[model samples]
Target chain A: MIFKIAWRNIGRNKRRTLLTAASIFFAVFFSCVMTSINRGVFDKMIDDSVTSNVGYIQIHKKGFWDDQVINNAMVYDQQWKQELAAIDKVQTVIPRLQSAAMISFGKITKNVLVTGIDPAAENKLTNISNRVVDGEYLNADDQAVLIGEGLAKKLKATIGDTLILLSQGYRGVNAAQVYPIKGIVSFGVPALSSGMVYMPLAAAQYFYGANNLTTAVVLDVAGKEDVEEVLPPLYAKLDTNNTYEVMAWQEMIPDILNLKQTKDSSNKVVTIILYFIVGFGIFGTILMMTRERQYEFGVLLSIGMKRGQLAASVWIETLLLGLLGAVVGIALAYGLAYYLMVNPIVMQGEMAEAYTKFGMDPVMPASVALDIFWEQALTVLTITTLIALYPAFVIFRLQPVTAMRS
Target chain B: MNIVTVQQAQKTYNPDKIPVHALQGVDLTIEQGEFTALVGPSGSGKTTLLNAIGGLDLLTAGKIIINNQDIATFSDSELIEFRKQNIGFVFQAYNLIPVFTAKENVEFVMLLQGKSEQERDTRVRELLTAVGLADQIDRRPSELSGGQQQRVAVARALASKPQFILADEPTANLDSKSTADLLDIMLELNQKENITFLFSTHDQRVIDRARRVVTLEDGKIISDERVS
Candidate 1:
């Protein structure tokens, strides 16, 4: 019966209730959108960072990550490869034999990071085969090289042209190789595009005199979120002697992780400001609601209704309004978020230039995670509950006789 | 048995600033089954005395004893419980909950008392019938006439089976016929159920029906007389 009264009382003044509820509704909607956008941007950053550079997880020699030299390369054991492939959520692993070298075709010579890769496994990890812009991608048995577009331009070399690579190999062995470029690939990152070379794993290893050795094993998982769950078990399955270190993408790029945290903290400030404005709106409406019903409250009190009970009923009324607003707001926010996710807003002008220059896509999308919706809705509802204390206080200190006379 | 005793009651509004004394050393007693009226001109302390006896307002000095218990000693929550179990009130404006039907308005007090639905239903029906609102039970206050709303208020006041009913200018907004009809219901309840009735009114019709009339002037009782 008290619930009935509280609900019906909400309808007694439709405009007042709607104004209050609308404030809460907008709070939920804006909060959800803000949180969704933040999550989407962060997700995109992580995805680009993982797929373009770090893969989801990486296994490196204990000291190799600190210094990337040919001497620190470990043997690429076929047994370890087959065992890791059998683990669940392990999509594929690509072993990279990387070394710095100076390449020359004719008169121009530039320093480059030459990567030795198994074509099929590298394709699965970085999709490098599809990124080939000119000529064909290299095969496992091919002695040909894949040169980056920027590197090829610097060397004035085209497909089928031979480029001379000169560098010191493992244990300071003088190493040199001349390889015909089979493919030219453009990378999203300018730095990578300008100073990269790819060759068949056996050919590069034989040339560098570091046969069957790889610097890192990059592991691509089924999904980005599964990295943490798959890491400990995968680590246990490999290197019980602790000769290798498994690093997640975030650990590999602590600078990007720090930047994301800074953005998240700023987003929280925005959410708090939005709630602060909406709280005042709700407070004003509830103040008017209580003041307007002073006579009715007095009547109820004088007729044996306890002030505490009356105050409780008023709180229930505010809760009902908050629930209505939150549910509707979440529904509306979900619709907008879903639409944005499907047709992301394309960036233009300066923003597009800035994003593309940094090797990231220029579009802005919204995430449709249920956690974002629920968390935002609960926050707004808590604000509504806090605003309700104003009316509750008014009812608490009410003097029935004075109220009735007024 | 005396249902209410107001001993040397004194009431002043805004005592800290400029005190306006509404009641001064006023003494009154009301027994069960008595249909009494506290009559006075405007601001003559009749309503203040009624409010004091009903435990709705605290007296500046002196004590109000209801059913041999001093209400001044009770805490605010205790007074609320006491009122819920003992006293009922009919306000001047017929302050029925606007959202409730006549039946719901009457049953609400009993609901607060934690009466069972079956008990509340039977009593609500009986009281609304006694107040001649049997046909208007389903109608909300807005849908009913002023007289009908007042009748529902009276039924609501009697729903908890209170020791007495305090009415302050209950007939002020009613028509002549509505006033007479309201008086008839109160008189019937007084005669048949021995329920005490106390009212503060300026209306002569309410004064005429009362068996005992207490007149107040200048915050003091000037006369207390009994009529045959």
Candidate 2:
């Protein structure tokens, strides 16, 4: 009987009920969209930095990350490669010999960070072959180099152009080489686009006079979120001594992680404000309903309805109303997020330039992760539950004689 | 037997500020199965006396005893339970729940009493038939006429078979014909079931039909008359 009364009571003022539900609906919708876009932007940032440049996890010789000199390079061991590959969740292990050198093309000379890679393994980690914009991709034995598009533009170098590279090799030996440009590649991050050069691992080791040496081994995991999971097994399989330093992307790039944390904190504040507004909207409706029905509550009380039962009935009504709004809101948010995920909103003009300057992609997409929908829905319902207590307090304190007179 | 006894009932409004006595040591007794009317002008304590006897308001002093139990000694929840089992009420505006159909309104009290479905259904049908609203059982109060709504209120009041029914200005919102029909139904129920009734009213028609009339003037009972 309480349930029946509660169900019917919701329809007593249809317009008021709809207005309350609509407020909740819009709150959930906007919060879901806002959080989804925020997360999607961060996901893009991580992809640009982690997937394209630094792998989700990296293995370097101790003290090499702090000092990138060629002398700190580790010995290239086939046994280490087999051990890393055997770990669960480790998708690919890419070996690289990296160093800084001065490149001269015609009269233009600029400093560039050169990385030597096994072409096939590098392609598996970063899909670098897909990023080739000009000329052909490099072979594992090619006596050639791939230059970033911005660097090529600055040097006025094109495919088949011979570029002069000079740097100190292992043990401070003079290292100089002339190699034809194999391809031109573009990166979303402006710094990487303007300062990177790639060559075959063997050719780079030969040029640097550091045969059988690699500066870093980048591990591509199944997902960036799985990086921590992959770490334990890799640590257990490799040398227990501190010879190899395992670094997750967050540890490798603390600045970007700090930026993401700040963004998330701000997003949380905005979401709380939205829920606060939603609570007021629902409370307003409840106040009106309780005030208007004061006399009816009196009659119910006088006719032997207990205060707890009456309160429970009203709470059930509010629960139903909140659930109705939240379900519809989640469905609509899911549809919108799914659409945005498939066809991301591309930034243009100044916005695109600003994003590129910050070393990020210019497009914004919504995350369709299932947690966003349920988390927002649960939050709105909790607010509704709290607001529903108002009517219960009124009913418990009601005097039937005065109420009926009113 | 005395079913209701009001002994030195005193109700003073705003005692801390300027005290306006609504019931000043008024006393009365009601026999079982009697149709009684408490009649007075505005602010003469007729409704105050009725409220005091119905346990709807606490008196400033004195005791109201029903079936040999002082209602003043009962707690708030106990009073509510006492009223549910012992007394019924009909308001001037016909306070039927707007969301419920006539049948559900009639069955509400019995539901509170935890009556079985079979018992509640039989009693609801019987009460609605008694009030001449058997055909309008499924209609909501909004769909019913003023007379029909009042009839539903009466049926709801009697649904639990209380010892007495207290009605405050039951005919104030009704037309003459509706009032006459309502009075006729109440008279029939009183005669057929021997159910006690007490009403506070300014309506002459309601006063004329009562077997006993108690008139108050200035918070004190002036006359108690017994008519045919």
Q: What is the lDDT, from 0 to 100, of the residue A79 in candidate 1?
A: 90
- Which residue ranges in model 2 land beyond 4 Å of their true spot? A171-174, A209-212, A234-241, A264-281, A318-327, A356-361, B1-3, B116-118, B224-228
lDDT of 1 by residue, A203-236 (tens): 8888789887888888888887888877888878
Model 2 per-residue lDDT tens digits across residues A1-406: 9999989988988998898888888888888988888888888887877877788888888889899888989988788788788888888889999999999999999999999999999998788999899998999999999999999999999999999999999889899999999999987667788899999999999999999999999988878779878988887866737787878898887887899899989989988998898888888888888898898888888877888888999998888788778888889988998899989899999999999787677889888888888899789778878988899899889998888778
lDDT of 2 by residue, B1-228 (tens): 999999998999999999999988888999999999989999899888888888989999998999999999999899889989988999889999999999999999999999999999999999999888889999999999999999999999999999999998899999999999999999999999999999999999988898999999889999999998
Please name the candidate that would achieve the greatest TM-score relative to the true structure: 1
The TM-score values for the models, in the order shown, are: 0.92, 0.89
Docking class of 2: medium
Kindly provide the TM-score of model 1 when superposed on the true structure, using C-alpha atoms.
0.92
Which 10 successive residues of model 2 chain A have the least lDDT summed?
Answer: A233-242
